[model samples]
Target: MRDVAGSWKDLTDDANFMAGTLTGQVRDIAFVTTAVATGDLSKKVMMDMCGELLKLKDSISFARSDRERPLDVEPVGGGGTDAV
Candidate 1:
């Protein structure tokens, strides 16, 4: 009976730790998304991640880079629309 109780406590602790970790990750993602929506691309998810979360982080980074790239483009003749 004592061993059973100990096992249950261990399980509970593990669950709590996982919950906290996931919650933090979710909040981080939310903050980054919000910043992006507000036209603030300076924020990036700096957390170390894996699995699906890693993919999400990569996607956000890709989007930020895509947005940043256009700012670097310059027209050929002191700023005039390109003639097709």
Candidate 2:
């Protein structure tokens, strides 16, 4: 039962991470396209986009690592008592 719960938590986390990553990428692309349309495509803008892309890649890597490892859960105390 605990194992199943852990798996569900991991799946939820992964889904959240992926959704966040995709949203960020979409936003970045929109920003870049807007800049280009406005004829403001400077070296700095390109560099900024590259940096954001790298960050997205790092996030994906971190998510993959989390999926590969065992899910970590903390114990909670019972009701109003401090003891578990």
Candidate 3:
């Protein structure tokens, strides 16, 4: 009975630790994405993620880069060089 109690305690401790880590990571991701939504492209999701989380991070990065890209525009009079 003592050994079973110890094992259960160990399992609960590990589960709590994992939950805390996941929560923090999610919070960081939310912070960065919220900043991006507000037009703050300077913010980045710096946390390393795996699987679906990695895909989400990549998507956020792509959104920021897309906004950072310069648009090419032609001169109004057509007599000047194109503007970048």
Candidate 4:
């Protein structure tokens, strides 16, 4: 028989690499969004990503500089900050 165990290990390693990359992208995006939410408008999605995510990254980057971006509205009839 062939060395099937080695092939299996290789496949597992590939899968692990892919999964790690995907999860890392997610974590990076999350961090960037949180930073933006805290008024860090300079944050952008700079992680490696796939097709749709490439578009999303571009969108996020655009929003970072888009002057038309919606401002943070205060809560209506509730406790909230008055800062504009």
Candidate 5:
């Protein structure tokens, strides 16, 4: 019937929209990752993606925070190691 065809078309359209959104998100994340790998740690991902894509965004945020944190401590005054 005509109604069935219309419903199917609508379903396919929704699927296409979701797929495109997911693809774009994935590519965005990939670019962020590449940038991070190339010593650019300031990049972050923030968006209202669906399902696990949201989790991926959250993980990327955490990674950025961790990367930005100072991991080394320099000795105070003079060129010498701290008395440990």
Candidate 6:
């Protein structure tokens, strides 16, 4: 059971790492788009960066929703507790 718990922790860490990396990539693309739009860079480059940024944003939203899902729990025993 200890080993299983350790493995689960490792997996959670990896998922967090991947989410962070996705967010970082989105930020980098936004930066590049701003730099390009300032007339110091190319329009084509800005467009490409914007496209990648949008994709990353969608992915991040999905990941966040998945992470926030409510856990399933059951009530133990009957009648003694007050019902809300």
Question: Of 2 and 6, which scores higher on lDDT?
Answer: 2
Best by lDDT: 1
Candidate 4 lDDT: 0.76
Estimate, for each residue in 37-69, the C-alpha lDDT of model 1 and write its tens digit: 999999999887889998998999899889988
Ranking by TM-score: 3, 1, 5, 4, 2, 6
Residues 1-81 of candidate 6 have per-residue lDDT tens digits of 144567798988888887787666656656645654464343222222246566764554454455457877677555468
The candidate, 2 or 3, that scores higher on lDDT is 3
Off by over 4 Å in 3: 1-6, 79-84
What residue runs in model 2 are displaced by over 4 Å at the alpha carbon? Answer: 1-4, 43-84
* Residue-level lDDT tens digits of model 5 in 1-84: 244567798988888898898888998899888888899997777546867888888888788889899878766754585554
Clashing residue pairs in candidate 2, if any?
Answer: none
The sequence of per-residue lDDT tens digits that candidate 2 reaches over residues 1-84 is 144557798888788887787677667656655654565544122223347676754554454455457867666675456983
Off by over 4 Å in 4: 1-4, 67-84
Q: Candidate 5, after superposition: displacement of residue 62 in Å?
A: 0.7
List the candidates' TM-scores in order.
Answer: 0.75, 0.46, 0.76, 0.66, 0.74, 0.42
Judge candidate 5 against the unseen true structure and give its global Cα lDDT, from 0 to 1. Answer: 0.81
**Weakest 10 consecutive residues, lDDT, candidate 2?**
41-50
lDDT of 3 by residue, 1-84 (tens): 144567798988888888887787799899998998888889998877888888988988898899999998865857685655
- The Cα RMSD of model 6 versus the native structure comes to 22.5
Provide C-alpha RMSD values for all models, in order.
4.6, 24.7, 4.5, 9.4, 4.3, 22.5
Least accurate 10 contiguous residues by lDDT in model 6: 40-49
Cα-based lDDT for every prediction: 0.86, 0.57, 0.84, 0.76, 0.81, 0.56
How much is the lDDT of residue 2 in candidate 2?
A: 40
The number of clashing residue pairs in model 4 is: 0
Give the CA lDDT, 0 to 100, for residue 24 in model 2. 71
